[model samples]
Target: MCGTANPCITLCAVLVGGIDGLENKLPLVAGDCQREVADLSAEERRGLRVTTKPHISIDESLREFQSDGALVRGLETPLVSAYVSIMEE
Candidate 1:
């Protein structure tokens, strides 16, 4: 989670997906990544979410980050700094 490039990007993506789930009131389901997504039946795929959405990247995550003011002040800066350090190299 730390010392990686754009770590928040990945975290944000996941949080965005979870936000989608919460917003949509989607039910939770267990999915196996070991199996191909296409191989899963519609029933098995229900409530499953991906880190990114179609036509959107980290933008959704940025929106999510912005909405939570308290969170952004403390947590995101360090992660963003790490990502910046990676880019500088």
Candidate 2:
């Protein structure tokens, strides 16, 4: 969690498809993303979450997304490695 000042999970609401919804939207499951996301000090991955709704192992889902289809579907955006730039001010 990024603290009350920034509730990142709420942001996940609209991301899931209307049908697939949370199922289709890729979330940080396990491995480095878990620690990496927790270690983040804001302005990193603003819209991050630990989702179990999909039921798929975190690592497997993530690895599946590491491919090119994830890009074509717009499910895998390039915001993970980069810092969150949007400002609330």
lDDT (10s digit) by residue, model 2, range 1-86: 22322244224323433324356664544333555444555544444433333313544433443443433244335542121223
What TM-score should be assigned to candidate 1?
Answer: 0.31
Error (Å) of candidate 1 at residue 67 is 22
Clash counts for all predictions: 0, 3
Q: lDDT of all predictions, in order shown?
A: 0.53, 0.38
Any residue pairs clashing in model 1, and if so which?
Answer: none
Tell me, by lDDT, which candidate is best: 1
| Reference-based lDDT, residue 34, model 2 | 51
Give the per-residue lDDT of model 1 (tens digit) for 1-89.
Answer: 12332556766756766766787798766544566655656665664653333323344444555555444443566764554455545
